[model samples]
Target chain A: MTDQNGPQLTRIQQRNRERILEGALTAFSANGFRGATIDQIAEEAGLSKPNVLYYFGSKDEIHKTLLTALLDLWLAPMLSLDPDGEPLDEVLRYVSTKLDMSRDFPRESRLFAYEVLQGAPHLSEILGGRLRDLVDETVAVLTGWIDEGRLAKVDPHHLIFSIWALTQHYADFEVQVRAVLGPGHDPYAEAQVFLENLFRRMLAT
Target chain B: MTDQNGPQLTRIQQRNRERILEGALTAFSANGFRGATIDQIAEEAGLSKPNVLYYFGSKDEIHKTLLTALLDLWLAPMLSLDPDGEPLDEVLRYVSTKLDMSRDFPRESRLFAYEVLQGAPHLSEILGGRLRDLVDETVAVLTGWIDEGRLAKVDPHHLIFSIWALTQHYADFEVQVRAVLGPGHDPYAEAQVFLENLFRRMLAT
Candidate 1:
């Protein structure tokens, strides 16, 4: 995971790297990057501190590695927003895909949340560069749809933000959600229904 | 602010407490509770550590105090959703008011985000008890509106959660929003219009 074009690692090396990242995700999500330690991450990963360091040069490298990987996963949903598809269906798919990520990759969601909450110290450059470009492209698609009267005219950027905020809230504030929801309620299932109706109603031309 | 029923504090005492809380807000927002320390809070507060201790018995007390205060502020928008008002208008007003809070109280938003992100160790009880009860009451009102055909039928709880998720994103994710929007864009002002239109269209019977 360190070098994009680096030599392929052995099977054992691959498994160990995955384990370390999974452990780092848990530790960093529970404790912010500043509060997390390499020893703690090593313990979480079930590798010795020295062994963990053997894969990554420092804690910063581990964090950056985790974030770099997460950014790609995070970008997948937006990247898949098909510009040539039926506009409403395309957006509904994007919303559902993002919600699925929140449910399936909750740790990744919280880890990213923590990073952004602390001013995105590691993510600022990417947020301005790659992320900005991606949103711009998606916005253009939405604008095209609006121009054709295929979708309602709303601020497309804020529309994307709304999808993100609603979907991620279920994961990021899972405890509060579960507590308020009490027992027996499937929050995500209900949210899926709610969000579909919401975007559908709001986006109908 | 510590003891609500206690004797009133002198003006100087009140100012000192406010200063400490302001500083703690910055520290805790930047660094989660575990990452923060008395010395850091004191340094941020511009008080001696002993002085900080003198005002608040422990770091936990200060954090709890800040949260307690923030909770009241957070609840105000929802609390003010008058049952007698036009249902759609009430909801739109609620969204606009919440967006306003995000603009005026970004630090408080981030502080609360940090606490909740870490599972709200200091706030679990309130989440299940008071917060749950408040939401139940609000949801009841929303359900009543839907039954009366005053508002569009939707999952009232998820509706509230959507409002929260959408509004809070601007504040909690302010840096990312700012970066993506680039310069010269007023995110909150733009958000206010977008949200008002969103809830209005979604909730109209």
Candidate 2:
């Protein structure tokens, strides 16, 4: 657990850290925070458990690291919701971006999903503070749009929730979705069009 | 596990069964299926482990019973999405019903959420077969409404997913939701109006 380098990880150290995080994500995503183990993550990362601990200190540390990293990525789309852009277009683009992340980074999505499912026990502080603050700011931006007559009058908070729920459905329920849609169906394509139409209609004055 | 009463449970038997299932639901919802234990459910139900097993044979059996019961209740609203009724009104009713379930039966909702989160490992057959079959039938009803120009054209599958995600969001993310909405905010009332507007707009031709 000693940081001999003291705040300066070497290039190789950075690579190893990334490797450990990547493996931890996969393990944690599959088995969840409570179900996943240090051994499994270490094995997945192709490192000894002691070496994994050497870099991350403990299981909780690794989980917290992955969670913080995932939160940053997950909130990026919402953070990009442009106040100056066309309201419906901005909302639709945000939905599209979230769906794309679901497809591209399902593990991260599931890991976040699992954490939230367990009542956000591990990340309650982050949820209450950082996440809530960001949502409040975004809601203000959305309210501004509605006031400017760029978007239909709607509860901005619920609108954001709708966007989040619809986009994340494809990733979180991929197994059931794939089964029902059949192998030929493209959920992302269908989702993009469906969400655009949904928000457009919802926001149309 | 034997039905000595022949074709129906006695009042006492039914009482015990309900107690066990309710306790199991609470434990499973909190800790998840794999994380839960029969002994814990037994203790929660205030019955000996052997007595709990007497009603439900095994942990798998207890889980299956709870899940099957939940599936029935969960699908009741969707099943009632009447082709005979006005399209938008019917869908709105369904949305409200689902949101109400999330508020009143959050433990049941969370149990199912956990099961689906874990890939529905034990209920894949139910999800893939019975669940998909029901969705197909519901999709046909929606398609008929669209074909008749009673509702706006949209992908039925994605529409179903949207309904599910929005309604279930209150239960699955209750912690974050409650925190963000503040202690006094009524999520159900807000959800009811929000969903009504959301689906109404989405389905309006």
Candidate 3:
């Protein structure tokens, strides 16, 4: 069995893998890891259960792949936080970009939110290693901005947490947001203006 | 089978009921609703499974009771948003109370967070009805403050959302918070000062 599965994938393998992942994200995002089933993923992907298992050894493997892919997409904005750029403008841009992602790609946002809510059991390694490293670098960059008088001195970790909380609120709490904001109100538009003004005022020297 | 349940017991019934709920909260918070079981709750409460079921008809009933109780406790501070009080102060006090709850009643907070993270399937009725109504009233009060020139004109709903996001981050993301903040940092004290400055700056007339 091990020897049979040793080699790299062909184009058919790549296509089937993509199909399975697309379906898995939807199921996992909506039902959570424990609540989701491989059969459901198979049906959603329009593939047989064995076929699904053929691409990935188990549900755990598929989940890890999805999470790793999401981590990259989710971390893109933070990775773009330029240490040399104008501080306040850079922060505002980050906030706006994050809010945009929340609006445009709510499923991916919710998937990340779900994993983190579950104490990130599957992604603990990623959180402990990759996420921790990224955050440390960002905090160091933020501390430099503060020391240079380019930004107000605040706890860099908490500042990042606040930014995350505010931006992800629109996506993670969409039901509440939509209900309270009413059907007609555009939350993203208001969120953009509110966040820009908020970060600008909060970080003003 | 229906008659087997019989009438409720005297003092013992109430006492055991409370014990069951307390134990369930710990289990449910730690393992989530799906991951938890009556056996674990029974073991935690020092009662057998049948004895636990005697008080609550099913695991779902126990979970519902805990959720209902938590909703009341969770909404207490928001309920105290006196329309006649100073707007920013009322809001600040509300924020502080929530932060305190996040610290003191973290398990309860996590239980609620877990529910919402799972799409709030079990509690959506209460969330959509009672919780929604309470937020509406709270938003009206904030809007009144804005209209009266008592606070900076801002989107009241988003304002409330921001307060919730900022405060709950301490508890809901406790692992991440500690990991990033380091081993010795006191998140609550720093959060209090940071939040005070944040709201003060945002709401300053």
Arrange candidates by lDDT, highest first: which order?
1, 2, 3
The residue ranges of model 2 lying beyond 4 angstroms of the native Cα positions read A1-6, B1-13
Worst lDDT run of 10 residues, candidate 1 chain A, spans: A1-10
Model 1 regions lying over 4 Å from their true place: A1-3, B1-3, B7-12
Name the best candidate (by DockQ): 1
Tens digits of per-residue lDDT for model 3, B1-205: 1122557667888788878999999988876787788999999899999999998999999998888877778878899999999888998899999899999988888888778767787777777678878899998999899998998877787888898888887887777777666678899989998888788778866
- CAPRI class of candidate 2: medium
Docking class of 1: high
lDDT of 1 by residue, A61-129 (tens): 999999998788788888887878999899999889999988998989999999998899899999999
The candidates score, on chain A by TM-score, as follows 0.95, 0.94, 0.93
* Per-residue lDDT of model 1, residues B69-142, tens digit only: 77887888899989999888889888999999999988888888988888999999999999999999999999
Cα deviation of B100 in candidate 2 (Å)?
1.0
lDDT of 2 by residue, A141-201 (tens): 9999899888999998888888778888788878878777766889988988988888889
lDDT assessment of candidate 3: 0.84
Tell me the interface RMSD of every candidate, in Å.
0.8, 1.2, 1.9
Docking class of 3: medium
Report the TM-score of candidate 2, chain B only: 0.92
Indicate the TM-score of model 3: 0.91
